[model samples]
Target: MAFVIEKPTLKDIAQMRALVSDEVKRGVILERSEEEMANAIRSYHIVRDGGEIVGFCALYVYSSSLGELRSLIVKESHRGRGIASALIESIKIEARDLGLEEVLVLTYRERLFQKLGFVIIDKTLLPNHKIWADCIKCKHFPICDEIALIAKI
Candidate 1:
């Protein structure tokens, strides 16, 4: 199957919300508001097959030297078909093109990121002021178990 991966537009927000909301319900990801997704639509990339969205990811740039990969989700039926890998590669390319020095990710899927050249790192070693804003509101806040990984772009 072929998948087209590209930045999202306002019209794609609804489908993106549905995929994300499903992942939230499955407890595989955090909940995100459609309004917020739409507002940051430029940061998102999606995989579509025959005009149907099957996956989505976002690269959150904090500075020219720093970017974070977030909101990676693939439809249940489409998992393990390399959709996630493709999305990650796309973000890496975008990060490099934007002159980002590195890209970081906080995720439970440690092995997946590792296979993509990301190495486990001390979260504190990175400047993540913006991450804390979202972290504070997370249910797993103080005891967050997600692993932090970074890949030099």
Candidate 2:
């Protein structure tokens, strides 16, 4: 069956939250509340396979010129099916449509981002304070090892 990519809606909150929670448990992604996802539902893109949410991602616009890719997660059974890439492309299109000049991502999967045309950069180089606000929730806030990468659109 073909997967469908579309923006999330209120009804998707439970599934979205569960998917994120599962990822967090696996230590592969950060945790986000259902309320948070509901409020930011417009910024998310999800992949559904047979009506089940198998992949998810969000594009956070911090400024007119800057955006961040956050909470990219694909179901373990759905990896290697191009769902993640599809979600990333959807975010990139939204970023470009919003007139963003650059997009940043903090990810352990450097090679994946690199292959997608993202270049590694120093985390300190990002001057957005709001972006760092989320860092406080991270266990490794003071010593994050996730590589920061940017792709100019």
Best-fitting candidate, measured by TM-score? 2
lDDT of 1 by residue, 1-153 (tens): 456688778998888888788667755576768787877889998998778899989999888799999889988899999999999999999999999999999889999999999999987876768557577666666787888899999
TM-score attained by model 2: 0.93
Off by over 4 Å in 1: none
Give every collision pair in model 1.
none
How does candidate 1 fare on TM-score? 0.92
- Residue pairs with backbone overlap in model 2: none
Please give the lDDT score at residue 68 for candidate 1: 93
* lDDT at 62, model 2: 87
lDDT of 2 by residue, 60-150 (tens): 9888899999999998899998888888888888999999999999999898888888999998887658446787677766687889999
Model 2 misplacement above 4 A: 1-3, 128-131
Cand. 2 Cα-lDDT:
0.85
